[model samples]
Target: MNSAVTTLWEEAGFPEQTVIQRAVSDPLLAGQSVVGIAPTGSGKTLAYGIPVLTRLVPNLGPQLLIIVPAQELAIQIRDVLTPLAHRLNLGVLGLIGSANRQRQIDRLKGKPAVIVATLGRLADLIDERKLRLVDIKTVIVDEFDSFETEDITTIRHMRQDGLLAGANLGLFSATRNDDDIAAFREFWPDLQVFDEIKTDDTRGPVTHYLLDRQFEGKVQFLERLGREKHQRVFVFFNHKHIMQKVAGSLRFTHVPYSLLATDGRQVQRAEALGDFRRGRTNLLLTTDVAARGLDVADVTAVVNFELPNNITTYIHRTGRTGRMGESGTVYNMGNDHDLRDLRHLLGDSVTLVAEKPLVKKREQDDETNDENTPSTDSHDRARTRPASDKMPARKPTAAKSHNKRKQRWRNKKNVGKHW
Candidate 1:
């Protein structure tokens, strides 16, 4: 590592290199196309950032290009590396969407040594001839799985177009299944794989609680949790509508909270994130837009108002809480179906909290009680006679004798009249 980069790392107060950081630093610095897999908040940015910075040649027109899934992530990586890049007298720029295009074009004239960009905006700038990747020597794809097919195609196209013909590619993510591994293999035939994803050890130990509750109950519980816990909390919802609904509920309960989603304005998103980071707000309600690549510190707990539909998303959601060897809790509010899916996905990692069972369980219990209790017909039969034996015949009253005598006299008179 360069002395300047080492000084920056020490100045940042990091005790030592993390497992992933230590494992990949040498290989990345050696210009190998590497794929690093580790849990979230495992110092991935620094792992690649330091190596890229150490090899940066100032005034060499963007030798490093780092692409992330979202604009927030791009800005985050830029913010983390900008100081270190400056220490080495290297220019760094973060290009994202929803910003002034002309301003980005203006910054491009300065020829940054490192460019962190979101996929869409970067592609747009490249198409418009405002940015060029011809000089890029290292192409690092952070959160590689989050990139869509089109984004991957664009990057592949760039490489095929000879823009990054000789550049080293670094792909990093927290969660990668067999399919992801296969795709990586296809992308880079000889890609060096550095995986440190120990299910038990990665991201420390996160205590997961499966709260079986509906939407309304989940909202009520969140209000109570916010009032009682009073710690940094991230309430995650799978949908924007649910996040908005939760935000409204929190507001109705007078809980100090901020809303974050993909559709939010750039300024609003930044303000919400900033407020939460600065301790201005204790709770942040967000969708999956903030699920991956978000590095908020001291997130004491994460509440999943709506459980993610997939295992990968669930991993990322829970990952937000227990980070960097810090102990944290994940409260998941889901129905029976969601719980079943979670159980299938996470196995025993999630502790089933018999907290408020869903309506299904209550219905089942009611059915069981009904089976134990006697019905109306059964009660009547039991009161009347034993149901096991035959039913007794009915007996006539004394009025039958008088009616029989009167009917005989009337029949004799009618027979004589007819003759």
Candidate 2:
């Protein structure tokens, strides 16, 4: 490693290079194409970041190009590498869809040495002739599985056109299944594959608990967690509607929370993330946008407002906490059926402990008591109802029955008299 890079690492107080970082640093510095598979929060960014910076020439025009799936990820990588890049007299810039294009073009005029960009924004700039790939030496795609077929096609087209002919490629991700491995071979035949899943032990132990609750109950449960001191929680949801619903509920409660939406503007998104990181917000409500390659320190726990649809999603969500050898907890909120399915989906990869009966009894009592209290806000009342009390279907009202009879009579009269 370069002396400057090593000094910065020491200053940052990272104990040592993680397994994946050490494995790939040499190969990457040697200008070889490498695929590094490491778990989330295992220091994967710095794994390739150090090597990329060491090889960068000062005042070079975009020698390192990092392509990520989301705007937040791009901004995150840029932020993480900027300080180190500056120590070596290099500059890092982010090109994301939510930011102003004119501003990015102006920054491009500065000829930043490193660019972390989403595929779409990068492709646009390239098409407009505002950004050139000739100087790019190391092209890395973080969260490799997040790239879709179209993204791969864009990359392949660039390679075929000789835009990136001289650049070495690096693909990194948290989890890569067998099918993903097969697909990688089909796409990048010459790529070197590295699987560090079994070897990388940097992730701290994360205790998983099943919170068997329905949607409203989940919101109420979040309120309860808010009462605890020093709780920084990342709340993950499978659907945007559910996330929005929960956010609305939390707004009325005492929980200090922030909402991270995929379509939100860059500034708003950054502010939301900043709020969570700076401890202004105790809970962050988001989808998979924050699931991959996003590292926030001291995230004590992750609460799943809804169970992830797949094992990979589950892994990444739980990974939000328990990062870099820090102990964390995960609360998976769902009903009995959801809990059973989650266990089946996770299989042997993770073990889920059921929430204790005593705790459940207390929570249920709290919910019942809250519901018994009077409140003018119908929404609040609806949200605090115990999950069990919400199951029975509502009976048809008199107004609805009268309207249905009138509609039937009108239809019958019109059948014989079609004038």
Candidate 3:
């Protein structure tokens, strides 16, 4: 590590390195092309930020180019690294979609050491000749899995056009599957992959629960849970309409809440996120747009009003809580179909909880009846029915018997295989 950069890093109060930082810091600083996979809030920004900052030379025109999927994430990365860059007498510019293009061009005149930009804005600026990548030494792509093919193509074109010639590339994200890795490797054949992600076991101290309920029932359940728990909460939905409906339901129930979604105005989104972060509102209703990059501490619970389509979305949604070893809980509300999908994705990692009181009462009554009845008599009664009973029984077929025997033998053979 560079001595000046080390002093600035320590001064920034990050004395201890996270697992990702420790793993990739050396390789990244050594100018190696690395692809890092780690959980959200694992200090990935700093892990790559340190390498970029350490290698930066002042007044050298943009030496680092950081591309993100969303403008919000671009601003976030700029906010995190700007102070550190300023400490070293370096400039950092954020080029996002919702900002003034001419103003950004004016800032580019100074030639900041680092430029954080969204994929679309960066491409536009590069095409207009407003931004040049000739001096770039490193190109960091954050949240690479969420990027579209066109975005990836832009990066490939940069390299092909010699704009980013000899620049080391680093891709970082919390979600990277086999297909994502394979797709990335097709573009950069020599990219080194490093994965430290343990989504199942390393989610800090989060407890996951599946609630059996439909859409309306989930809204009621969420209202009840919100009234009962006095902690910060985030309720996620898959669509903007669903998020709006949930927000209306919360408002009707007199629950203090705020909305954050992609459809909302930028100012409203900023104010809503700020209000939730500052504890002005305890509940935040949002969609997957707020799933990956938004980081808010003190969130003790996450509620999935609608279950995500895949395990990766589920991981990022629940990752809003239980951050940095603090204990948190995630409640997933779903019906039978949703439950089946959740089970297939999470396996036995999630606990099922009955959402309605009637269901719980009925289950308790069944348990009581089982305890009070005689086992032998109950079995005989179940097998033999009276003439008054309308239902009829038929004898089992030879094929059924043979299949039962085969299943029994297979079970016996694989008694402890799964355990």
Candidate 4:
């Protein structure tokens, strides 16, 4: 690492390199095409950023091109890399679909050293001959796991057309599967891949809980959670309609929250994110795509209003918290059947416990006794119960006690609702 960059890193309060940083720094700085996989909030950006910045020359016309899946992430990477780039007298620019194209092209006239962009907008500019990649020495594909099929196709076209022909490639993500590698190899066959390090020490300790919301509906539970003493909470929903409904309910109830939706206007989305980051909002309601790879500081808990369909989504959602070795909590809210399915999906990887209601002492001996005190939101009392992998034995409910034949008939009668 450069002495000045190291000094800047230390001045920013990062005493030492993170695990991912230590693993990828040398390979990246050597100008090798590398693929790095680590847990979310593992400082993957700096794992590549520091090295890329160290080698970049000032006054270069877009030497570094970082492709991301979403516009928000593009903006975020630009924000994170700007200060460091300026330290070396380099400039950074963001190319996103939501912003003005002419304005972006106007800014491109300044010859920025780094370009953090989404695939769609960058591809459009390249196709229109408004952007040049001649000076690009390194191209980074960040959060490749969340990219769609069209994104892959665009990347292939870029490489085939010689836009990124000679640039060294770096692929980084928190999750990976067979398909991801197969797709990468199909395009960049010579790239060296690094297997995910199981013993990742960067992710902090996270306590998982299955909070029962049978009596209290999921939205009601979120409302109550916002009223508690929690700092920053991320509430995820699988369905957009459900998330919007919850957001409306939170607003009606005066619970502070910010919504991050794919269809929101750029300025509005930026404002919402800024409000959340500044602690003006207690809760951020979003889906998986909108929140992926977003790093916010001091997030206390992650609440799943509706459990995700797969374990990969679960990992990314919970990853918003417990980042960079910070203690955090994850609450999976659902009814008995929902939680049972969630437990089955998670298997033994994550331990889930049923949160029990703890009594809150009142300043005066008031006549009203509210038993639904949320102790887990409190910093001091969040860890009142020991971590346990075993779930408590299920007590049969009246709905489950019914005969299977009748339930099958009822489900068939209400097939539309089930679907």
Error of 3 at 410 (Å): 67
Clashes within 3 Å, all models in order: 0, 0, 0, 0
Q: Report lDDT (CA) for all predictions.
A: 0.80, 0.83, 0.80, 0.82
Off by more than 4 A, model 3: 199-203, 228-230, 348-419
Clashing pairs in 2: none
Q: Name the 10 consecutive residues with the lowest summed lDDT in model 4.
A: 358-367
Worst 10 residues of 2 by lDDT: 410-419
Poorest stretch of ten by lDDT in candidate 1: 351-360
lDDT of 4 by residue, 252-306 (tens): 6668889998889999999999998998888999988888789888898999989
Candidate 2 achieves a global lDDT of 0.83
Candidate 1 on 155-244: residue-level lDDT in tens?
A: 888877788887888999987755554664565666788888873253656677778788888887777766654488888877787677
TM-score of 1: 0.81
Listed in order, each prediction's TM-score against the native is 0.81, 0.83, 0.80, 0.83
List clashing residue pairs in candidate 3: none
Per-residue lDDT, model 2, residue 205, is: 85
Say what the RMSD of model 3 is: 14.9
Q: What does the lDDT read for residue 172 in candidate 1?
A: 91
Per-residue alpha-carbon lDDT of candidate 2 for residues 136-241, written as tens digits (9 for 90 to 100): 9998989878777777778878878889878888989888855555555554567788889899888888889988787788877888776577989988887898
